[model samples]
Structure formats: structure tokens, C-alpha cells
Target: MPPPASSQSCAPAPAPAYRGRFAPSPTGDLHPGSLMAALGSWLLARGAGGEWLVRIEDLDPPREVPGAADRQLAALRAFGLHPDGPVVRQSERGDLYRRALDRLLADGHAFECHCSRADLAATGGIHRRCVATTRRPRPAVRLRVAPDARVAFEDLVRGPQVQDVGATVGDFVLLRADGYWAYQLAVVVDDAAQGITDVVRGADLLDSTGRQILLQRALGLPVTRHAHLPLVTGADGRKLSKSESARPVDPTDPLPALRRAWAALGQDPAALAGADRVTDLLPAARTAFRPQLIGRGDTAS
Candidate 1:
């Protein structure tokens, strides 16, 4: 005999509040490209009357510059882009990631992977399954993306987006071979823990969204809204990255860079014409910001 069905219908859960975040790697000082993303995220959060949080992605110690995280936070404050709560650091949250990884492994949503770069070179670097004949003592952990798995979501800034995760990314990493948590796993766990309702960052990370979404589903976490701002490029038409020695923005004088970033977002230049300080400029910019007006293509810095 089966139990009687409950009278309540299985409706979807209510959406969370408008909580947004700006997460930056502590690789170097805040540069034009990074500042643009920070400002864009701050404006969107302020415009929507939401809380804006900051997180330092310092999981990769080898790549991180000493004191870069503190400098980044200082620069953001100079630009009047203050976070609503205490800043979260990925380095301090390893246990959360470990628990999530354990759950995925227990549920068969993830597996231990022994394959290295050379092993999957023939497959164009996409890991479908374990290809190594010999397993290392410390193998990496990867999510088991099914062959037919597809993720679709509406990007707040880029509009409707879809990605075939299995075919394109195939069994992405959750933990690296060096015993470090991968960005996909750390970000998914932190976002859910922080109750992030929106993720607004540079378009350079747009491709990683699908993997994060899949991880969220596997972990039974809420998927946040995404808005990827256009990437800031250099004269060579390449993305401005901290690793390439992109010029860092001066915190002492932030108006020029702020205005330039505002223009890059396709917002009206006149909107910030009379503003002389960061405080005055940020409110005006927030009031004038229109997400629909942001361009899809990368902008020259």
C-alpha cells in the first residue's frame, strides 16, 4: 500500500532578495578592466536597491601577489564602491568546499580523475573520463557531466544564453591535482552560502557560467542571476589581464577611470558631467545606469 499524496502542490521556491557580489582574484592591484567590473556591479546593485558584497578569490597562492587583496579593497573604497557586509575570502572557506565535494563524490555526481593535460591533448583538453593508465596518489576531482547535459539561463545583461556543458566542457574540475579547490566548486559553494542572488562580473568569465550552473544543480544550490559586463581590451585587441601587466588604476585619483568605465558601459557621459567626487559620481551613475544599454562586445580601455 502506498501513502496518500499531500494536498500541497509542488511549487517552486520563492526567489531570494537582490543580493549581488564582486569577486576578484588577488593576482595584482586593481586595474582598469577589474575596476570596470567592480563599478558596473556596484551600480547594478545600487540601482536595484540591493546589497553588494565583495569576495577575494585567493585560492591560487602561487599566482597571488602579497597584499593585493587589501589594495583591491582600498581601491574599491576610494571609488565609493563599498560592500554591504564583511568581505569573504576563499582561502578561509576550504572546509565548506570540502564538504560540498564530499557530497558530490558520495552521490556519484563527481569522480576522481587521474588524467593530466598530456593525457587529454588528443581530445582537445576536454575530460570525458579517466584516460590515464596509472593513477596518482593525489588525483583531481571532476564533476560527471552526462553526455546529454545542457544548461540554459537568461543572462541579465547578455540576454538568453545556452551552453552544452557535456559536449563542450565534459567532466570539469572541482578540485585540482595540487589539493586546491577549483574555482567552479569554490564559487558555487560560496555564492550559495553568501545568499548571492546576482553575479555581475566581466564577460571574460561568461564561458565559466555553464559549469557553475551545473555544479549548483548537483549541489542543490540556488542559481543566481548573471550579468557579464563587457571586457576591457588593450590596443592589441586582447583582454586586459593582471598577468599581462595591465596598468593599475590610481586610487588617489579615481574620477578619470570611473568616468571612462562609465562610458565603456554605454551610459551617458553627461550623466556624470558635473560630479567632482566619487560620492557624487556613484549615485548619479547608479541612477542613470541601464542594464539594457550595456554593449555585448568588448570595449577598449
Candidate 2:
């Protein structure tokens, strides 16, 4: 059964003057890598005199850790990154996703896909066309990507970006066969519903930007400004993610982690050197943050 709706409704609301968000999944405790994303997004929003909201991307139940969402929120508060509005959880927004799927199906932008991973493995995992010989009771739904489908956008940090979505990823899934809402669909819908004006996240999600842009155009949703910060990587040059058991940040002593994340974003170290509290550190960091100074590539945590 779907979870009950959160305190806030998923219905589209009047666009805010300027809005940004830091959405985190409840797969584990807040780690240094995730902290960088949160801090980066918060700094961008506050620096621009915009509202920064928090959204819990708790859509995958099987992978979620119990109590992780509350812990993540508590840690953000400890770091003095408070949301301007009530926090929202994606698990409670099923109705919104369903409505989006219905619209896509009705318009012929999306179709039922019976292809499995194995069925498309020979084509490098790109779902170009249906290859399933036998149809399954539950089929994934995918957005139809045209042969000439292309998306081009200017990223605040990375500059000019372009992707041929049809050739690169083919017709991507909107609803998985496992009966779970795909991240691409949920994020695009929620961003529009929340009236997000800018999307500031890690560079790791850069590839997803084009796909999301396509979704925005297909749904007639406003395309938000994007800035992808440098990712925090481990000694092995791999991204330090929750799935890899990255060490969790200590909310009890947030200054050190906060400082590290600030440096990871390529801001000057002296900007937050004297800060002994999160309250003082955040304002100083926000004032000194320059998106142009943020470098591309992996930042060792």
C-alpha cells in the first residue's frame, strides 16, 4: 500500500520568487559527500536571496534505513541549514506521480515496456525498442525518445552541456516493473510542483540533467537553473556514497564537517576558518561563495 500523504500536498502551487532544494534519500546517515551537496545547494539559494526547501527522496522502501530521514533532518538543523518551508517526503506523493504517468500515456509520450535488463543487455543497456518475446503481467512504462531528441542547457558550474538522449539512454523508464516510481519521473514532477527555480546538486548527477530537461519539456514544466558541484571522492577515486559505507558526519561537532564540505565546494578556506558555530559559519560561507570558483572533477574528502 502507498504511504499516506505528508502534511504538505503535492498539488502545484504558485511559483515562489526563487526556490531551491536539497533532496536526500534515507538510505543511510548523512555522510560527508551528501553534506557537500546539502551545503552547496543551501549556500547557492541563500546567497541568491532565495528560499531553500528540504525534500526527503524516500521513494525506495527496500533500500531505506529506518529512522534515517529524521536523523538526516536533525543533522541538517545541527549544521544550521534550515528549510524555509515544511519538509516533504516523496513516498507520500504517489498521487502526483500517478497523475503524471496517466498524462504521458494518454498523450502517447509514454508506452508500456515489457523489456527486461537481460533483453536489452546486448545493446549496452540502452532500451531502444521492445525485445521481450513474452509479455509480463507488470510492465515498466517508458517515455518515448525520438531519434533526433536532443537537450542543450547551460549549467551554472559546468557551462555548456548537450546530450542526445535518444542515442545515449534511448527510451528510459518512468515507472519500473517492480512497481516503484522511477527517480527521473518523481524528481521532475516534484520539482515543478514545488516551484523550484534552481537545482544545485553534486556533479555525480550531471548526466541525469538532460533526461530531466526532456521530461520538463514533455510535461510543459518550467526548466529550472542547474549547478552541479564537484563530487567528494574517497582514496580510490570513487564517489563516497552511502552505499559504500561512507563515514557519517558528526552533528555534535558540525564545524569540522561543515568546513570540509565548504572547502570541497572550492571556496576559500579562510572564509570559514574563524567560525566556531554553524550560525556564524553559514553566513560567512554564503557571502563568500562564488559558483565560478567551483572547479570540475572529484574532490577528495
Task: Specify the highest-TM-score model's number.
Answer: 2
Candidate with the greatest lDDT versus the true structure: 2
What are the runs in model 2 whose C-alpha is more than 4 Å off?
Answer: 1-12, 242-245
Per-residue C-alpha lDDT of model 1 across residues 1-301, encoded as one tens digit per residue: 1112222111222435788899999988899989889988888888888888899999999999999999999999998888888888888777777888889999999999999899999999999888887788999999999987889999988899999998989999999999988999988887887788889999989999999999888888888899999999987778888335369999999999999999988899999999999889988888888878999999887
User: What is the per-residue lDDT of model 2 for residues 74-152, given as tens digits with 9 covering 90 to 100?
Assistant: 9999999999888988888888898888888999999999998889989998988899978989999999999778899
Query: lDDT of each structure?
Result: 0.87, 0.88
Indicate the worst ten consecutive residues by lDDT in candidate 2.
Answer: 1-10
Error of 1 at 163 (Å): 0.4
The alpha-carbon lDDT assigned to residue 24 of candidate 2 equals 94
Q: What C-alpha lDDT, on a 0 to 100 scale, does residue 267 get in candidate 1?
A: 91
